[model samples]
Target chain A: MTPHDDTQQAQTRAAQEPIAISERELTVMTAHLEEAHQATLPVMHDAIADWDERLRSENDPAELAEMRARFGRPSRRGFLIGAGATLGGLVLAACSSSDGKKSSGPATTNTKAAAGGGLATDLKIAALAAALENTAVATYQAGINAATAGKLGTVPPAIVTFATTVQQQHKDHAAAWNAIITGAGKPAVTGVDTTVNDGVVQPAFAQVTDVAGLAKLALSLEDAAGATYLSVIPVVSDPGGVKTVATIQPVEMQHAAILNFVLGQYPVPNAFAKTDGARTLTDKIG
Target chain B: MTIDEQELAELTSRSRDVHNDAMRETREPLSEIVEVGREHRAHDEIDPLAGREFAKQRNLQLGKRVGLLGGVGIGAALLGLFDQPAFADKPSDIQMLQTSASIEVLAIAAYTAVLGLPFAGSLPAVVQTFVTTTKDQHMQHLQAFNAAATALGGKAQSMADPVLAKVVEAAKPGLTGPGPVLDLAIELENTAAETYVANTGALEDENAKKVTASIMGVEAQHVSVLLAVQALLSGGLVDQIALPPPNLSALPAAAGGVGFPNAFYKTDLARAADEGAVK
Candidate 1:
């Protein structure tokens, strides 16, 4: 860091004042800063400056465009990140800034950050979780609908049941999260324009034909969903919330087993452990 | 200054217009964007190892925002297939379907090659059935991938990586023997499962997630089948049915649901680990 670098850095920081810092940088900064709770804005501004420079210099124009489309929204990603940091009190002031536009000024303390703590009150995390669940539900329903529409074979009753049931569970989870957000008196998540477009879903549905393929697809989805929930569960504060997520989590494993069973892949001859095992701890902490 | 109710309302109205203008001018529909990926060349000398390294470089270039929206993992996966630009983007549902199909093709090649192993001659009836069924599923997976990709106007690659497919073909006879072939099969199955698992998080499209899940299920069965064959070879009790191993259960629920933990870990580190024997 030369004096020139420092001056450039300062100028860059000034320019990035209002833009949100990304999650990765927030993590790094969170580790670097002692969480004194002051001077947080500088770190975010610096991150934004760096992010803007990087995006400007990126070789892949398409990727950059995608980012602009997805994260350019001001509060969607940025506010969500702020909410996440504040709720956890982790000082990782991640600003996801979904709207692509850069905000002006140095980072300013906001009411959302002031409202941090407890599982129920954390609007950011709740909103994110709800959004994620809603997306999954929407995605799965779309997949099922597309699969049925393909008419390759009779959409097995079991396949229909699995997709519908799991989707319902996701819906319920989203509702529960919404309830929590409401109880906290925060606005529930307002969705983005990223609807479950049929163009995306129809092709995935085309990948399977028989009951086994359908079962297999369902099992894989549940596994992914289950893993996502598991990764977040430890970070979540509400025991009730944790339990709710956990209960939903195992259903994914069970779904995997059911698919395996249908495909004649189930139960170890020697072991009693339910197959379709969840990811191990070493998989994460390692 | 914070946008108060009135300012906020005014800005919101204005922002919509800006967004509309932007959309009209800059929004390339997904189909067009996907075409860019599809039309991109598969670099002749590219390997998964090189691909992974390329991703690391790209992510480094991407800066802090790398992990913000959906995170850097997708970037990493995209990098893994550096040779295949089509597979590199934050995989769409159609892309996922293609990848899953590619994996199935890989699995079929792997399983079919395994049959030529001397070990195949000595396998028990049940174990053989497992292998046979796994091969069948891979074929099914191939069909699924083709149908999905073709439907979406994307051509599914014959096999995602030619080197791995060639290796499977070349290694078939030698791998026919029990210890080496079984281990190789197990490793291949794990690798495929890991690939699907990794893709689960990397993809943003809902359809992609579903397709990735379908591939994962196939991989799990491959695991089950391989495990049964291994158990049978060892004269150990085989499972009543092949089942997906519980490797992902250990991850806490936040990162991924428990079932998908670190599915990307080994793939993420495979080259450094000298684990890319598939080549």
Candidate 2:
């Protein structure tokens, strides 16, 4: 393609899928990295008396509950609630509606009923993951859109390429989860988790006048995504489900590491990834 | 609770058939809700692959493949080593964990050698710091793998990967500088990453999968960082690898994408789960 054509193509691509790159994005998440790294390694298995005793006792509630608290129960406020806990910045929870009543905002309206009314725990995890991936896809698109609109100013070609690849990977991760959902005779989760969209992401996007601002949001986003994946692989029952999540977890982490580097921080901050801000099953899907 | 005996048997059956097929097919183990919580028999002497006759056959075969890839005499020598019952066509959680520990052993050894290079003390502070940190991380990974294995009633492997140890041993003399050293380090990281990736899909235990997958992410991160550092070194921006990189914009564009060349990390080049298992 000619230079003009290349520029037009780049512009079109950027408009379609924007990811603003900046140190601002990197800084938003580092505040939590120190605490996350310092988390005590949970050798939880050591707590069990024996395999048969542990397996036989549904009474064995402690480990499961301990783990579930790490990733479960999404609400419109939960996205930023977790991020606020981790990133140490920006409370974006939805509170007042246009008419001044306590309202759920536009987020709660898009909710689809849990597939078939209830899904298996593995399937629930899959659905929750699909929505998170969908939210990520939209998040990157918003960044690209902001950059293309000249709001972020002089978006670098390298940043565009980074956004493009990272966005596509999120798309793939969504598809993998959806495949499992659909294969199990459920509807594919086709919408972004509304809680993240309205409560956290939209507000964050409006504030991102520069690449760093947008990148900061994206970095926090990937940190949670990677952590959630780690949280579930141990308890997510299906081997296929574990494999699918396992493959994607590292990609999210790589994204975070690079962002950390861009932000002038240590790349791999934790010896092992932590679940401090991981998402569990969202109310969006059973 | 637990997986029913019939279902567990079916899973075992399915895994066996897959193992029989040249060990090329992916074997899905029993659902691990029961596996991870299952107690490791204290002092259990049971061999993980005792009954799977073809595991020995596959070992001989993998040894052949290694010989083909590395031009070594391993294939011909494998049978003599497995005359005992320790070998099998199927790798249980123990063998996989042992193999992982072995790789970690080799990695720590490689990094130690890198630190001991005659000029190592004078290497860039960032390179030296990275070498030291990564070695420590590998040591941690080794402990995690051995702990997981012993938890599952298996002996821990304390030796370096016999095959890759040879490769690293041969590559040692050329550890003369960052370029060659990083190249070997990347290979080891990729192999570790990819092997763990495959292990997540193959291992029978949920905790094993979780542990393997988490380590895989870090190993892949090592690859990403190493690749970025390699790019900086190649561009002759040696000073740029410094933590809190000297100047972000002054860095080359390759720095952006070099770290993650692929969108999805694959297991195509993954080392076999049994390649380094202690016999």
Candidate 3:
């Protein structure tokens, strides 16, 4: 580069430095997460209550039984059945079972190829994606709260900025998947994936006492989310669904890469993105 | 880290299938080529006329099986669309594989050159580790793509991307420190990541799409780390950039947000799929 160009490059590099974030910016960055929990959360609960009652009042036994027969699951499907089966066969699949049949040669060589096929599998995956997004959003929010309360002690400014920024992105991811769900005339998933919540997040997060601990906990979630997206893209039948998840996946990887740096690890740990951390598609949920 | 047993099994199965297919494809042709070579070597002078006759026969028989060699061999160079037997009717997957291998080749070359630089000697230990590990990864990626391509009846493109090789050459003279080299590395990585993201959707083969997407994730991670390092070097925190930070708390706040600027990785910087195809 010329002397003039070098001067410009220096200026560009300087511009990349983090500036002091305003309190309002941080709050906005967190999406007013406290207010979201205190105020909007109850509103969601109340609305869900009314929605649930309405469905129960109009509940049809024959349709519910048919939904059970078709879906054959209790946890994830009952909700979908209760929400109504206008989307009956169009939603849910034995994806976890079918996905198991395909060889990983890990993403292809579907020699046994058990996928029930099209839109149903995509919807199931969409539900799982939304749940995972909700899980991430909640995890970041908890991290922000713990830091703010001084429970983790002296949180770094850049990390706070990352939390606010990244959690909002997760919220956006959740909304994107929900939009696809509701667009199909089903209710949006408003909660985290319970399988992940109970088995992984809650158990691991309970041990987080310091910033390093919190960072590690968060990294696991980010890693799983990124890997899950990688596994889903090939099997998801719809072109739109594939595109939506593909776009969000790099962002998840970016999240993990940053976390790797905070924990004093090589940011890019593997040459190929691994599915070892990919969330298992349980016979029930998650 | 979580373990998905089924995913692991499938991964094993995938590796086995690729291995079996590669071995299966090459076993016969390799043997024929060897037999031909022995026949030729037995001749006292290996007559020029006889060599010419063998060449005509070899091209007719084993050329398609062995694939037109690339720069690393006889002609791993570009084959006409109709000439590729496995993917002749569908060359997009072959193009993606060839172009990816080309980029990996260029990455390996760039890092190898940087590692030998006078300034590179003084780079932070962690940075040195990053450079070496990333170079090795690119080598592995090159081998994987070439293996897949050769298995699919396409030539293994062991050549660096012609377009970006020139870009790296033009910038190498300006590399006063790790920062400048990091800039070049980051540029190549971001382009590869974005291109792979684009490739995932456009690739017709299911396995190819997943493989491309999987590698895209790693490339994106590389871009993230390099971006973070760029920020640190710019901030003059070279001493603080350790693998296990002497003090993670002392690392600047900017380190957190600097790594990931885009919520969605963009494809605007991606190279065209066939841009580096060995044509």
What is candidate 1's lDDT per residue for B1-279, written digit by digit as tens?
Answer: 111334333433443453344223222223343443344333332244544443444333333322211231344543444433333332244444555565567777777766766656556444555566557656655664555455444565565444344545555556536667776676666556545544444443333333344345346445544543443334332332122322212111111111212111222211111111122
Worst 10 residues of 2 chain B by lDDT: B22-31
Evaluated with DockQ, which candidate comes out highest? 3
CAPRI-style quality class for the chain A–B interface of candidate 3: incorrect
C-alpha TM-scores of all predictions? 0.36, 0.68, 0.68
- In candidate 3 the C-alpha lDDT for residue A205 amounts to 78
- Model 3: fraction of native contacts: 0.43
Which digits, one per residue and each the tens of the lDDT, describe model 1 over residues A78-192?
1111123111111112333322121110111121232233331233445545555555565554455444445435443323434554555566556655565444434454331
lDDT of 2: 0.60
What are the per-residue Cα lDDT tens digits for candidate 2 across B40-146? 34334444455254345434434432322244444434545456435453236677888899999999988898888888876666566667777877887897787
Q: Model 1 residue B271 lDDT?
A: 16
Q: What is the DockQ of each candidate?
A: 0.02, 0.15, 0.19
Best to worst by lDDT, what's the order?
A: 3, 2, 1
lDDT winner among the candidates? 3
